[model samples]
Target: MKKVVKFGGSSLANAEQFKKVGNIIRSEEDRRYVIPSAPGRRFSSDTKVTDMLYDCYHQAESGKDFSGTLSNIRERYDEIIRGLDLDLNLDDEFRTIAENFKNKAGIDYAASRGEYLNGRVMAAYLGYEFVDAAEVVAFDENGNFDDRRTDKIMGAKLDSIERAVIPGFYGAKPDGSIKTFSRGGSDITGSLVAKAVHADLYENWTDVSGFLMADPRIINDPVTISTITYREMRELSYMGATVLHEDAVFPLRKEGIPINVRNTNKPEDPGTMVVESTCNKPKFTITGIGGKKGFASITIEKAMMNAEVGFGRKVLEVFEDSGMTFEHTPSGIDTFSVFVNQHEFEPHEQQIIAGLHRNVHPDMIELESDLALIAVVGRGMRRTRGTAGRIFSALAHAHVNVKMIDQGSSELNIIIGVENRDFETAIKAIYDIFVVSQL
Candidate 1:
């Protein structure tokens, strides 16, 4: 059984952390394909290598003297090399990087160096061949990832090597210009590798032991989720839960390969397992609770709104014309409401309101701001009855008012809208009912 392991920035911050990662890899023979991110913070106050590179590049772009910044970044890697007591020297690599920065080779090139240099170090430490991501991961001229070309090339490339280390985050455009994925993109690289190699499992090692049932900032010592399905994960992630990049699930889910989120510091803990489907039952009535703030709701009331043909489409067209995306729209026979990002809506609010008046011609249009949407998602919810009632009961007991609630047809998740002030309280209430009480 082959497994692809991806280590996060924190896991390789310094030589000591690097040693830990090396041991983790050596412990398992199946963990052959390795992916590494740039060195992260060694301490809370310390700067990450990637951030330093970005600063250095910014200074260079501004035509300012940036040698000091470049020297500092080099020192960080030198310290790691010294600690490891390796014979490897990065003088040539650093010289090339400095030259590229001086030539204004683009921020993508500067940002990618973190991973590139780290990959070299990791390969040297592990005795594995180093594979440059730019040569394998394909991107189009528009800077969009070309997954078809990437998979074909990556698959052939990996099949030739028994063990290798690939840097994550950034790939190359067709013209060889560098392009990076959004922040936290290493997760995407790992997933893509797992798919290309057809690995049985993708192990993502980070600081956390696993995904928690609720955000820890709100609920003290929240329970960790042992197993979560792709659909449930998507719902929780969309609502703000973030152990892995949401996009990472796409490639692995397509191949039916599971991902295990493990803690690098505490290797013994069996972290969260994400899968395509499972017959195993969840520990609680809900899998996870996550929510975000800064939403505005627009309520449109018209007589016999449900009976009016194309009424919903007309109302939505106004938002589309305004270039605003609606998050959720729950309606009744006479009234319907559109929920959207408050900041995005504010700029186009008057235009959207005017369009709604012209297109739908509703009797009344009311706007409410400062709303938060909470998702109570679980696969077990489909089998359990009164899930919505339990959520309402919990909120009512906590004295938190619910502004709106929407449940999809699949019965996989329930969305609750509340005032921003009550977001934390509502989440705690739901956690107590579904998790704390059970424990």
Candidate 2:
């Protein structure tokens, strides 16, 4: 019945949030191991503690006096300590960090202090043992995460400790140098620890209650997804859902551990359950809709293209040679199109187009910009027939012309391309047919 619980930056932003987290941890006996991120924004306009650390490091690296920046960061923790009324003295730790900053510690070391400091305070408040991630987590000399060593060491460390708070985000290199994962890496550490200990569930506490069926800005209070399979989650995440860190799911998914995406502010609310598989039918037709903009499509046409054996390969090689990856390639008998993000082609636009003309030599090449991709993801859709047909029909009713379509081999997700201007309208149309029409 063990559970690996992770609290995001917002959940640990201030003392009040800390109290709530302590209560949640204390209430569950099996919640022995905890992973915490740096203090997040207290309000919409506030900067995060991690961001401040990065700024401080930048000031130091640029040879600018960062005493003021360092003090501000110290003040943030001081305020939290004063509010929590903790007896632990953080002066020594603060001083040590200040010294490190003066010595110009790398950005990774500086960024990691956020989680390290927060974990210290949380452990003191909850009367739990504090385990430094650097001691248990390991990276090879090449700076790659040594998953095998990390899993073995972390498993042994947690095996002996009954209750502990482990800082997230950064681990130690083989020579003991500090290294960090990409942003929001606390999610990765939490999942790794969960798999190491073989927890029954991993709870990711964040600001949002759960994943919404569509972007709230586009669709008002879109239905919250109660349960989603890992395959479905991958699709939605790839398209643009920000509910959970998609990469964090791998470790837990391999071990068959379900993750509960919960809201720290609203602990009473059942957020979302991300599982390996389920036969449960969704209350709504579409589980979620997400999309991204800023795409460009290159339409190439050639006579008897279907008869040419290597037509597609010849067309894609131009992209590979020009150092670009194709997002989607939907083809017809005599015409084929390759879709890619516009931003990726910023510097090499003309070269790529010219190479395509020289290598593939199509009759004509048309470049269209301002495109968007939308995904309708749901496990239920795979079982219920005509899900794709219904989605297309809804878009047709809304007069939204879908430019391209691609579905994964799993059939858990269907992706459609449309003009950037119609992204919101297309999402609304799909939501109305799948969610509102029933209501």
Candidate 3:
């Protein structure tokens, strides 16, 4: 029945939200551990506490008077402490943070203080023990997460305390330098804790209730995915779904721990349950669909290319030498195509083209800009037939030309390439084909 709950910045933005979190924590005895992010934007126009800390560090680095900015951050925590009516004296911690700022703590260290300070306030409000992440979360010499060491340390620490609040985001390196996860990385911390404790559920409390079938702005009132597999999540996330941190998936997936994506504002509604596998049927034609535009494809055609050995390897070596990664390589007997981000290839386009000519010796090389990739991912697609046929029919009906198509062996996803201008029309056509026609 144990659960490791993590809250995003939006969930811990203000004193009222803090109170809501306290109630949620107090209601469940097994919700023994908590992880929090820096205070997020209080309103649309305001800057987040994390952003403010970064600004303060930049000012301090530039030898500017940043005391006012630093104090505002301290007051945000102080106001939360006062509103909670806690007797905790945070002067020492505040002084410690201020001294670090004066001495020029790295940007990661400065940014992490928001979560550290907030963890203290939250612990006092809930009457739980405060466990600083820096002490327990370990990083190696290279700054990669030391999962083995972290699991051992965190598990032993939690076993000693009944309830605790652990700040998220940054951990300490071997030399005590602060190293942070990418933004929205608190989810990864929560997942690591869940795996260490073997919790029954890992709850990610954020602003949204659950994941929608498609981008809301594009498809109006799209259906929500009630249950999704880890594989399905990866596909959708790769296609630009933003519900859960992709890096956070593997830790829990390895231990078979299910993650519940829920809303702090609407706790009563059962949010999406991300599990290993489920027999529950989807309410929509596809689980989710999303895409990113602005990609460029390199088309290389060579007669009798299949007759040559190591041709593909030689071509790919050029990309590696240029420090570029290929997204997809769809090939025919005599032709091969490499797709990559347009922005990434823009700088090295001429070099890449020249390298290809020198190494692979293609008959013709052409570059197509303003390309977009759309992914239609679902487990239901595996059970149903003619999925590809239906997709092509829909696109043809809408007059949206398909540039390239790649379907993984898992059959969980099918990515279609289209022109950037035709991106919206393509998605609408496919969604209507599978979703609207069924209705």
- Per-model TM values vs. the true structure: 0.99, 0.97, 0.97
TM-score (C-alpha, index-matched) for candidate 3: 0.97
Compared with the true structure, what per-residue lDDT tens digits does model 1 show for residues 63-87? 9999999999988888888888888
State the lDDT of candidate 2 residue by residue for 141-244, as single tens digits.
88899888999999999998888899999999988878998899999999999988889999999998888888999998887889998878888888888778
Between 1 and 3, whose TM-score is larger?
1
Candidate maximizing TM-score: 1
RMSD of each: 0.8, 1.3, 1.4
Model 2 error, position 124 (Å): 0.5
For each candidate in the order shown, give its overall lDDT on alpha carbons: 0.94, 0.89, 0.89
* Candidate with maximal lDDT: 1
User: Which segments of candidate 2 are over 4 A away from where they belong?
Assistant: none
* Model 3, position 57: C-alpha lDDT score: 90
lDDT of 3: 0.89
Where in model 3 is the C-alpha error above 4 Å?
A: none
Tell me the tens digit of each residue's lDDT in model 3 across 226-281. 89999888888888888889999999999999999988888886888999998898
